[model samples]
Target: MSERETWATRAGFILAAVGSAVGLGNIWQFPFKTAEFGGATFLVVYLVAVFGIGLPAMLAEFVVGRKSNLNTIGAFERIGYRNWRFVGVLGLLTGFWILSYYSVVGGWVLRYVGGSLTGAYFGDAQGYFGAISAGPEAIALHAVFMALVVGIVAFGIQDGIEKATKLMVPSILAILVALAVWAFTLPGATPGYAYFLSPDLSQLRLTVDTTPSFPWLTFGGPLAAIIPFAVSQAFFSLSLGMGAMITYASYIDGDESLFGDSATIVVFNTAIGILAGLVVIPLLFAQGVEPGSGGAGALFISVASAFADIPFGRVVGVVFFLVVLVAALSSAISLLEVVVSYAIDNYPVSRPQVAVGLGSAIFTLGLPSAWDTAWLTWFDTLAYQLLLPASVLGILVFVGWVFGRPGVEELLRGTGFGDGVGSLWLWLVRTVVFLGVVLTLALGLLTLFGGADPAIVPPL
Candidate 1:
């Protein structure tokens, strides 16, 4: 067997990881959820969830990968817990499941990029989306998007994924910052900032009096419904729970402060997410488009419609969709890497062959989503609602339970921290983080089956 590839530099790994975290989840879904869950209200909860729940969970995966220095499943066996390999399997499956429909959405972003160039969607944004959201056009775009992912991963880590992300992540941040500056100059900027930055705790109070699937939500009211939503959103946004982090961390070389690296990745990811809101919310408010009015189609419809009326709308649309396209590719690369890492680790096949074979299969799976929006919804519901949270829950359990002392030791390596911090993280993983993930999964399930409005659930 050949030696495993590692990131050529710490910056490469950080950029790659941040690139994965800051994707369509930030640019597309974050804005929709902001509008759906009440602007700053959701923002406050999301921030808490990110630092509180997401950070520790991310560290747990970091410990697994850095210590084992292997693929997700192989990490378990390398760590002397072969029986716990199933946890990694679950994580791999979750990543694969997510990237299937995720590629379809990436294709949509690709289409919008072209549409923006020609001012195609500006005339009838909603109608254009409805016509092209699914069918042969979507399928072709999906194939194109997946092929880009395959080509990158096939070239190995440092040469392809690392080099590409180093360029893309910086571009994403710079462009978003410029867009946010432009957005703040709009006449309606005050109301938009007020909506996004000003906290209205009352908006979190869900007035739903009855939840047949999970009655506790009906009683706990705001805390019950919103907390879970925020938790899942943070998890998805940070790209945790799907072995992408684990796979990325596996490429680390030296004992370079995993905690610090994780913190940096989280900070960059959150910054981009907020930057996206700054640009999107203000643009939507300026055009008098009702935020969240278009449901999952909000980015294509509401945002596109806003672009239609703005001065130099065509240029702005091109830049914005270009940002989304870059973000989508960054994320899609990581998701595909998770499975590719697994295949090259366990099988005799070469990286390029495995990439092509697996990419084709994933593309085939996404064809259903490309064929119909309803199938896309089901794919999103299954991956985010069920697979993701469950995968995170399992990995946390393994870190806190099965992998115990060694995991903590691995965590303490680069930080120069004493055992106390490691122990505390272990305790949180064993208890608080563990319970938080369990609650996240349970709430996700309830939201899935409880006849809750599908709009409130995180789409893609």
Candidate 2:
């Protein structure tokens, strides 16, 4: 058997983990969701979800990975829960499922980067997206994006994943901050800031009377709906429940502060998410365009149009799309890594072979998404609304019940914390986090099957 590859340094592991967490969701989906919902209220609820639910659930995955020092499925096996290995399988499948469509979107971002450089999408942002969004061109772009992801993962953990992320994550942060600063300088940017930062309590108030509803079902109402959405966003934004964190944590070699590391990753991810809103919302407002009005093309059309209308538009467009490209690649690498790590651990295959093989498979699966808009929407709804949240709920159950006190002990192993802190963490996981995942899963299913509007459910 070959020796397991480990992250070369603590910082490398954190950067890789942050790279996994900070993806298109942080840049595009989060801002759109916030704008679509009551922005400030949604932001406040999302913060609560991040600390209350996201942190504990993340710690649970970290405990399994670091304690067992194995791949996702093997981590469960090492923890003496043979049947629970299926949870890891679900996590792997969730990552693959998401990346299948995610890579298709990443391909769009890549195409836009080139288009932006040449000012191809400058005048007609919507038309440019329409021209490249489907058919053979989209497939070819998808292949190119998948190839970049495969190339990175094929080099194994230290040489490929860590080094690439070390450069990409820092670059992503810098570009986002720069863009936000530039965006604020625009004439009408203050309204955007007000829309995003100022809470409207009236928007959050439930006007409809609900006297006889079930307590759980009562949460389905307008104001209450934000809770589940916030929880789902926290899970998605942290890259939890997809085996990415578990796989990344498995590469850590020494005793380090898991709690502190998780905190840093969360803080960076949330800051970037909010910063992306700052950049995107203000720019759109400056152009007299409403944020998130472009639906799935919110980032592509609305933001691109705003860029085209600005001074030095071409340069800004190029830089913005470049940032998107880097963020997309960083995330796609982690998604592919989840499947590659499982294959290398279980099968007698080389890393390069597995990376290529799995990359090809996912790209083929994503072709339908690249070919048809309806297919793309269905894929996103399936992966984000159902599979991802379902997988997360399973993990919450396992850590809270099956892993129990032993899991808490593992979580506290390197944190220099006592049992009291560990117990508090465990309590939150078993109670609040567990319920949060359950509600997120339920809300997602309601959106998919119960004929609920996505605007209300807000796909995480």
Candidate 3:
């Protein structure tokens, strides 16, 4: 049997991890979510969730993967907990589920990148998006995106994943910073900043306005509704609740500051998300756009439309979609890696074979989502609302109870932190992070079942 591969450098691992974390969630979803949940108030709640919930959960996953020094499923098997292996399985499945539709969305970004350069969608953004969103074009683009992802994964870790991220992550950040600076210079950009940075207490209060409809709106105040969204975003944005991080961690070659690396990923990811809002919100407000309806089309329609109206709109559009393309590709690589790692770890097959075979299967599974909007919506809700939270809860149970003292020792292996910090982290994962995810799950269920007001549901 061939030996397992490891990351060529600690920096490679960190860049790869950060690349995974900063994805479409940062570039596409964060700004729209902020606009929907009352701007500044949502930002505050999101920050709290990132530190309070996201950080600990991420570190916990790192502990398991690094300790076991194996793929997600292999990690649990090596730990000698047969039952707990299910968590890894769940994560692996979630990664597959997410990547299926995720590739479809990545395809949208790719299509727009081309459209931007050729001025294809310049005049009618909405019409163009609607036309391409769920059709043969969408499917073809999705295949192209998946092919790119497979090509990367087929190259193996250091040469493929690490090197790609090292180039992609820095470029993503630089583009975002430059766009944000330009956005702020636009006339009437202050309103966007105000809406994004100033808290509204009324928005924070849960108040439902009922209607005799299946998808009702139960506004559970900002604290009840918005916080859950923030928590989920933090999880999704950091690529938690999936085996992506675990699989990436399996490539680590030596002991290092897992805690510090986790923290850095969170910081860089959050900064990019905020900077995205800075660019998007101000640009929209300056152009007298409201990011209307906050659908999947929000970024494509409103932001793209704004670009159409601006000087050098074509140039801006190209840069913007290029950023999204990079972000999507980086994240898609990680999601694909989780599945590739599993196949390689368990089966006697070459990485290239697994990459192509599983990549094709995922693309086939994602066809319904590409062909129909409703299927896409349900798949997204299923993964994010149900599977993701449940997966994280399972991890918490395994780490907090199954691994117990050994888990803490694993976490403290490289970091100089004493047992006290480890104990506190464990407690936080068991109590705060666990409860926060539970709340998110409950809220998601409520929204999914039409118990909550549809009005309060974040834009699709």
Candidate 4:
């Protein structure tokens, strides 16, 4: 029998997890990254990444979660050697680091949610974003954001996040799609499409002798960029390489097909992400907004500005920002749920108390991120570099090396994929996924310490 908590219904479970995956990353971050990176070509690379990097890595998490049916740390302990416990602990720390900045960003969204109603950031959007993005004002908003997340976690999994998502995800999707539809009707979209969809040819000039920069910006530059982008995107999109999914899976019941449900979550998440790009890229393209402003607050600022100049823009602004507000909360609830689930599963801490503790901690730590964008970048880098790679590597080792092939194969068999998973996957888990993760970790570490030209380091 599966030990993790299951959703009261299949619909609740899929929607809740999808709610977690389909958030600011897809909506807010996707448009900005595409524009900033190289437009349509980058999107092409990213979509490839979604399939190769995200799909496989996601399956790995599903297998681990459904099999063990325990909270992160506990899941590791239950599966393999005592040392595996450290992996789980590391995952917890990873989540903590991510949540610190994530909560701050969440607050920024909350701030906009409130501001959109008043058009406070509507005029001179760039300057307004600069003024409020990092400071005491940001801190206050972060606290409010953390409080909302804590409130949901306190309410318990199936009861709170599931219910909230049931309300939030649909609204988030509806608004974004509507916005996309609106964006298509406008003009000046050709350049935006060219920049985002058509690949620039010059970036492809680099060959083996010369190093490439922004290859996707050029036509047929590096097919390799697709791998890192996809891997990283998968990590970001699934919210995997972190403990969130493990925590959610810990609460799942065994009778249902974990694979089937997880697939639904991934597809829904991808759709939302694509839809967000639809809203963002076309809008900016149709307007004459400079693509240079694609920063963290770019989406919030740009989208609001776009709406402000349009007919009936105020209502549109409110509707669009509300989409972001809901998306942020959905993901925030997942992050909060990680800790809250642990408290309920492992300790006698009442659900409400669990929420209070985790929420307070997130709010407090989130202050630094809110008040300092530098700190936010640091936390994101650390989470992605140190915590994620290490944790994923640790999991491969635990399942492949520690638990051995038989144990893992049994878990895969637990699903309807049946014996079709077979010896090949077992071999891959042992050799490819496990070894590949270690190498990726090494490269990530190297990138952290090894490469640094004077221009990059001092930014002269």
Who wins the lDDT comparison? 1
Clashing pairs for model 1 are none
Expressed as tens digits, the lDDT of each residue in 1-460 for candidate 1 is 4579999999999999999999998998888787777888889989988988899999999999988889998999998899989999998888888899999999999999999989999889989998889999999999999999999999999999999999999999999999999998888767888888998877565444554535455434555566666787788889998899999999999999988999999999999999999998888889887766876778999889988888999999999999999999999999999999988888888999999999999999899999998898888767767887889998888889888998899999978999999999999999988887787776677677766555556543
Root mean square deviation (Cα) for candidate 1? 2.1
State candidate 2's TM-score: 0.95
lDDT of 3 by residue, 1-460 (tens): 2468999999899989999999998987788888877788889888988999889999889988998878898899888887788999999899899899999999999999989999889889989888888989989999999999999999999889989999999999999999999998999999999999888866666555576544344446657768667877887899998898888988888889999899899999999999999999889899888743546668988888888888999999999999999999999999999988888888899999999999999999899989986778778767767788888888888898778889899899889999999999989888888888877777777777856656655445
lDDT of 2 at 368: 94
Regarding lDDT, does 2 or 4 come out ahead?
2
Q: Residue 241 deviation, candidate 1, in Å?
A: 1.0
Task: Estimate the overall C-alpha local distance difference test score of candidate 2.
Answer: 0.84
Per-model TM values vs. the true structure: 0.96, 0.95, 0.95, 0.87
Q: Model 3 off-target regions past 4 Å?
A: 206-219
Instruction: Give the distance in Å from residue 28's predicted Cα in candidate 3 to where it truly belongs.
Output: 1.1
Please give the distance, in angstroms, between residue 3's alpha carbon in candidate 1 and its true position after superposition. 2.2
User: Per-residue alpha-carbon lDDT of model 4 for 390-411, expressed as tens digits?
Assistant: 7776766665656665554645
Report clash pairs, candidate 4. Answer: 4-250, 4-251, 4-252, 5-251, 5-252, 39-196, 40-196, 40-197, 49-230, 200-218
